[model samples]
Target: METSKETSSNLVKRYQRYLKLEKGHPENTLDAYLRDLDKLLNYFQGEGKSPLEAELEDIEHFAATVRDLGIGARSLARILSGVRQFYRYLVLDGYIKNDPTELLESPKQSQHLPEVLSTAEVDQIQQAIDLSKWEGHRNKAIIEVLFSCGLRVSELTQLKLSHLYIDEQFVRVMGKGSKERLVPISPRALDELGYWFIDRNQMKIKEGEEDYVFLNRRGAHLTRTMILIMLKQYAKEAGIEKTISPHTLRHSFATALLEGGANLRAIQAMLGHESIATTEIYTHIDTTTLRKEILEHHPRNIRYREEHKL
Candidate 1:
């Protein structure tokens, strides 16, 4: 019998190939699935049982253990989902006769909405960039496209100049799972991109990187970490207090559209959400905005606030 580490490594590689080639999962999803599987493999090793030999009780115990570890409901659910997919693949490829994970239940999902930036805050972040510097145009354009298009950081990094339709005002984005979508560009964003291109053109362009829309001074594509660090620096300079990330801009984009009366389904398509339920969190955000307005300006609430003032 092979050792747990050796057997699990071979199976994990096979599972990865299946997810990437057959299921068309993107790189991030592939990595997540692998991480999820590793957790189970570690548990199985501790119990001196092979993953292929796991029984229903073994799976149940695993789930219970994860819950007891204080993992969040959303993450626990995804872990179970990943494990199920792995077993289903095992059953298909003849490594196992039956999937032991079939009856396992994911935890009930909890809604953890991300913070949304106000339009003024978004502008303040952009304005924090100094245009006199060489990289200023590129950084400003990055912020503009992020808020304007509501793109995932990966999608933004993979953006290409060839996919841009300046005349039609749409940029073709290759989004999650290798899916493609055309997102409209605001004129303000377009002007920023135009400025960026002028800076981009002056560089001694690196081969194979010329087609990529956002490149560093070394003439290579920007990494996701670079984007995060840049946003943090600008946010501090802008004096905005809310915790920010690329997804905060994404949430802001969706919330602004919802408040401006854009259809929910349209926002769903723009955000590339596979489900409308994923996009519906903004409705809660919209409601939160309404409640704030009532608390601040409603006649009854105003009088209560004034009376309660110490």
Candidate 2:
């Protein structure tokens, strides 16, 4: 018979493989889940219990200790989610008849809506660029690619020259978890990218760094922080007040599509969202635009207006 320690180790190893192969979780996410599970294992060991034998009270005690450790609401919620999945895995494998985490409730997270840029604001920022400087062309291309494709900052930074298919109007992107998807590129963005390439070819690129799509003046690929700083500078120059980031452009891309009557599932596909529910937040973000469309086209609204005409 296996000792409790051996059983626990084997279970954790099995769970890690499940997350990697079946769930396809990214490295950082998988690491976090494993750490959370380790916390649970430590708590169980203190009580002379194995995870398969943990009771509701044991889970509750773990939660209390986690809280006492001053974990933030968001982090605490993620940790609990990991722990719950662990219990669920045990039940599915027949190691436990019931999940101790079945009754667990995650803490409520505050709803913070993503900020989006208006079309005019976007135009103002891009138009404010000084194209005389060669770096200006590169910066313009960065902004266009970000807003046009709704790319994550990291994705934009790591984009390679080989990934772009200008003739096909598509750019291949390796998204979270190394999941590759081809995102459509707008003509305006493509035009700007072509212009940047004209200037890019003149630069003396560094060894082993020739394949990056966007590079700094020194020929190294742009960093995530540099993108954020550039956005902040442009936002100031455009006189837009609300705080913005590269992600603001991504949110704006989705919001504009939603307002333009694009299908939600199509938007989900373009944005590379794994779940439609994850993409549904845009519906909530554009309620005012949605209301306008309903009032303009709904049959009841049309009838009411027609009858009230004097």
TM-score of each: 0.59, 0.57
Q: Which stretches of candidate 2 lie over 4 Å from their true place?
A: 1-111, 275-310
- lDDT of candidate 1 over 182-289, digit per residue (tens): 677666678889999999999977899989999998999987668878998899999988778776788787777777666665667677664345645543444334
Evaluated with TM-score, which candidate comes out highest? Answer: 1
Model 2, residue 118: distance off in Å is 0.9
Candidate 2 per-residue lDDT over residues 1-310, each given as its tens digit: 3434457888889899988998899999999999999998898788777777776556766876787678877888889999998878777766768787875556656744557897778878988889998799999999988887788877899899999987876788998557787777766677889999999999999888899999998989987768888988988998888778887888787777777666565566667664445655654434334334433432323444677661
Clashes of each: 0, 0
C-alpha-based local distance difference test score of model 2: 0.77
The count of backbone overlaps in candidate 1 is 0
lDDT against the true structure, each candidate: 0.78, 0.77
